[model samples]
Target: MRIHQLSSAIANQIAAGEVIERPASVVKELLENSLDAGADAISIEIGYGGLNQIKISDNGHGIIAEDLPLAVAAHATSKITTLDDLYAINSMGFRGEALASIASVAKVTISSKTAHQEHAMMLQVQNGQHVLSPCARTIGTTIDVVDLFFNAPVRKRFLKNEKLEFQAIELVIKRFALSAPHINLIVKHNGKLVLSLPAAIHEQAKRDRMAKIFGSSFIKDAIYLDVERGAMRLYGWISGPNYQRSQNDRQWVYINQRMIKDKLINHALKQTYDGMLYPGRFPACLLYFTINTAEVDVNVHPTKHEVRFQQPRLVHDFFTSQLSAALQSDGQNNTEQTLQDDSSGVTSSFNSKLYDVAGEAINMAYSFESTNKTSDVGRPYRFLEESDERYESNFYQNKLELAEPLTSQASYVAPLRPLGSAQAKKNLYSDIDECSWVALNNQYSLVFIEQQPYIVDVLVLQQKWLLEQLQQASTPLESRPLLVPVRYSLSLKLKERIEELQHYIEQLGIRSEWSIKEDKLLIRSIPIYVPYLDLRLFLEAVADLQCIQISSLLELMSQMQRFDPKLLAIEERMALNQFLLKVQNQKSQFHGVFKALSADDCRMLLHV
Candidate 1:
């Protein structure tokens, strides 16, 4: 056999395999073409999850009768002409391969009537042949792709079930609808109306679209942002810390109006949201980033769902700063709003009754089992994927665990106790011989005891240390003034209840200021260890003091330990190392918490 150039039909089929992945891919390509043609109102009709037929009608600039043949030919495109055009792509698609590639795998009929033409022309193509004829239609375009993947058996077999496939297709349409809110979109599946979004040109109408898609609760919790710097502009709605989801399904972001999954963007957003949210929770966000087209290259990936920024670090920093400032400002505004209605506080009799509570201890052995978030920037639809693949990041790769005490913040004097030299280990733990600690996957720690190795949970150790520290309750907790006073809504009743528990609250190390005229409590001071504590939960602990145990107040301090042990930042790791060392110094006495493992168990752990 000799090497030879592949025929046009074979070449296009191979390209189709890359771009046209499933029914959704076909829908995406056709929609892009429609949008690129300046469509204002688009209609999509699907049958059998696009396996049987797909009809896309758009009122945009249409093809002329003379160019109907070339329109379906491979490499024929009006989007780009030279090498410079590829470098600065502004359209959703540039390569003319979409229509050609689509025709290679499906029966395609394209009908169009340009504004300059009195009559429309329709072209029907199948199996590398085409027929052109006069068509009666408006000044727009209609593409009907039938029998998708008809020429590609292997690709057809790789598709998911009909319902799942339709879901993926619907997701694509929704994305387009969001990016082009000014466009009117109507979709139908199996002759039943599925989605209909009328053109939204006003702010109120756009918000209506958002509420329809993400729910009214999302609108209630989300914050609108609009900021710009030089050639870059960032705008959209991001849910506050209180509104969160267990998964990233609601996170949608676009670059220059193109929806993409960029790791840089994800990392920046996650970094901006750090400390505000627990690692496991994801907030709902719909963001759009505007950058000069020439500054970002969108031709890097085959799917066009990724881009390369000319100045990635600069873009990342911009995203972080803007998000952080907006969120903080929003927090302050909500905290200071006035409430004028007057109401009496809780009854004095109710406040005078002191109750004792007995509850289970907080032993979070499984809290640190998995990293909360990944920087993969995954696809919008994961159910269509063959398997779930994880790509761990190197963003925190070079960072090492901290072995020193934490540095204090501005205008604060809280003692940061550092572990002493190896000689002073006697005070922390009564050990018989040499000992050391090794962290395992941020979940467990392996400590050596009398030359024997055992595993211990990191959270369990932290809790044990905290409980031991609280035994001598007379020692006052180190309190630090907050940079900005945190406000918690103080209802007339809750405020009275909190004032009654003033002694207990002070004992737990939270200081606040109460304004007689204002219905809010300003948290001016907090415990030195944790920078952020949930105000809602703290208030709950005060209100439910009769039911919540004595340890409940200190249990809220668990926010301090919410960090990835293995991927800790340089400074933070140093602080954690200091914390862990104390736990290590006293681990010898945490009897049942440490487990001895056989040689096989150790080997299995290492392999895992």
Candidate 2:
């Protein structure tokens, strides 16, 4: 076949293939035209998912009676005249191909009456054929596109199901609704009103409109953004970390009030939300960007869904810094509030007699240690020395085993049993309400409540305590300087990502630096509590942070060591007992991450 110039009707049908992909495309083009014509309010009606009939009425500046024919003509636009105008175009519908291409494939009837005109003029076109006539009165434009894709049978075959098409149409309407909150929009599908958004002229009204569209739950977790850099201004609502969705469909990005899907902007957004969200989850956001008309090319795509930026790098950096700052600021607020609440909880806990005794005992023990600092003994010192009369039971001597010391230079030392003298035990158990506890096999505690013994997993209490400590820590955990720095080799990409997140990583108590000569990452410090953490697993988990949180790493650190009662120091065991006592008194049972028997369970055991 030889190359030849396509006929006028074939050319238009080809253009329609690009612009009119579905009913949503038609809605988008018509809405843009309405918005470009300065419509404050618009109404849309759809039938059979816009395949049978689609009517749009808008109170905008109507086309001139003479220009009505030109409106349906190819390449004729009131928005732009020359190629130079494309560089600085502002109107949403500049190519003017929408009406002409749509008219070529569908039955189009455009009726309008300018404010000065007494009667409206109606222009009807069917497959490039036209008819002009005087019609009833109307102050604005009313376009009825019936039997869409009537001439293009192949295109009609590609149309989606009615439900899917209607969903797409609603999605497009929602995009414009968010972009121009001041535009009152009413939408009907098969005579049932699906959406009716009033004009949002004020900030409160705009927020209300957003809540209506996105839901109140999203609004509760949304952070408002307004950032400007040079010719670029970014403003909108971004969902917080807690408001992530399973899909990216919830993300709405707009450039100069025109909804778009620019990969550059989306990549920047992903970078901002890298460590903030979980894996395979997307943040629900409505981001509006305003840049100089000359700085952006909105004609990059036929559907106007993509744009080319003059300085893509600069825009990307601006978005990253501004959005990061906003999220970080919100996080800091939450952290401070948490710290305050924890402080209040500590103060309240001091009012309890058992809690006060624990605090006093710990303080007195620390004071004793400060005075004994001059002693040169290498062995671990006991906070509470056992009396000579308190005999070490076979349970402690035969069954207990000491854990390996944390540091390489240290050697494991046998742990001393915490059993007190007869008098001390009597004093401790006197207020127990006919209950007694005996450490069972060093793994469980058999608590005899009202003469019935119930087994309890001590590890459950330990896990709960560890979680509470990790979650409510007012300051970062204590970190120890490494005697020899740990080195990790990495690919260039992973290295760059780590360097980008170096600041955040350091804040989490792991200090790392890139070795210039060796070309490997050097870890200089680590949390003191988790001395045996697997550095490779920790770094990889941190690098691939989408699946978990930074705090989760700390939780992992705590979990690496199994719960062991014999390994705990005397003070720690006492503290565990105090915690369990509190739980029993408050709730009559301990309900930890692991299920432990309750007081009711203890009673049920006696019955059985």
Candidate 3:
């Protein structure tokens, strides 16, 4: 094949492959451009999951008559002109690919008129081909896109189902709405008003807007956040410590007016609420970050949903510190208010302040009836034989009788103390000499240096184990056979990397090939040592491993060789079974496990 300059239409179609991935992508780009243009009110209409048609009208600064034609032209944009402009790009569509790319895949008609002009101009284009010149129109810009992917049949087939696609589009609109509470956004799906967020300027108004979109209950459980670092500012409402959802859908983040999925920031938030929130639950947050445009790069991805920050560590620290401070402040305020309210009441009691903090409310009517009963008070206390031989024999017989039942129960019972008596506190600190290693619950090897629960990071340990197992399993000396061959769909870059390192993989006696039919890399042979292993998960781990440097890979490989597959499997199974048993025991014995950790334990667990 000879290299030749592609036509404008072909070039735009190629760009469309990246920019116009789906209906939602188109909506995101258009909405972002409207926001960049300072639109205070935006309205969106979609039909047939935005495939049949999509119309977006924004009351922003409309384009001039002459500029209307250039708006849909390739590489033509008002966002950037100079070389330095790329470094400090504040606008969302700096590349100017969205309009042209969208036009290449769909029929687009854009009508606009400046606020100062009496009439607007409309231009129509079909699949990168101009059909009509600028014509007169009403005020504001109304962009109508119809027959999306009409020119690209292959791309159209890749779209999801109608409901799923609509959901994706709705997600984009909600994120944008949250990002710009001052902008009124109305979305109509198939002529039905799916969402409507009126313009809100006050913090309460914004919270109400969010409640209308997410849920009304979110307002009561949300925490207001506002903090600023050197050059970065963070302001938003986050869900309280106990307010959590099952997924990350509610976690909205925006950097400099552009919505993004930043891993560092997400991790920082998780660290802030680590022990405060339940496991497997995510916090609902509407975080907005403002920083120098030059400090971050948004052009790294075609979708512009991901960004690279210059000072990721600083940003992470700032997020954790600010979020933690806000939550702590709320806790202190509530505590102080409770104390003040209690002090205002006149109650005759010994150690009034001490009792106030830990007082338990009693029903006055019930207490008066219970006070008349004195005969049953003595019946509450009972005495048993205290002779050593008799007590020891009873204890032994009870242990023998209860062994099977206790094992089935899997419940932990604390030793009881006499009522109204001074209880001795157990020493939490451990002596170094007495810190003998013991297998804990048949999983972790506990060596209590100072009575703190300690274990290696689970993810790191799992990865290390996997690496060692793969190495040994690849050896031809093993006789195990896999029941199923795992196939992995990888990016072109990752596929190339695998092929480059095929020699190393073959040395482990594992067979692999590129499956052109599925557009993936297929693992035809597995390591004999790990026949039960899930190959898909292993391949994903491999891809993650490839993301790091060669030195890190070598280090990982070395560390992985030390892992024992049998021991790993045993530990995993024991941990899982223990968890199941604990859940069952809790269901039978207790209402729920609301174990409160001591201040020292909290500090240790949170690494505070």
TM-score: model 1 vs. ground truth: 0.62
TM, every model: 0.62, 0.59, 0.59
lDDT of 1 by residue, 507-557 (tens): 766787775554456666665444323444345435655654456666544
Write the residue-wise lDDT of candidate 3 on 285-332 in tens digits.
888999999999888988988899888898889899998888887777
Comparing 2 and 3 on lDDT, the stronger one: 2
The candidate scoring highest on TM-score is: 1
lDDT of each: 0.68, 0.68, 0.61
Best of the two (1, 3) by lDDT? 1
Alpha-carbon deviation at 170 in model 2, angstroms: 0.4
lDDT of 3 at 421: 14
Deviation from native of the Cα of residue 410 in model 1, angstroms: 40
Residue 196, candidate 1: C-alpha displacement in angstroms: 0.8
Residue pairs of candidate 1 with colliding backbone atoms: 402-573, 402-574
Best-first order by TM-score: 1, 3, 2
In lDDT terms, how accurate is model 1?
0.68
lDDT of 1 at 481: 59
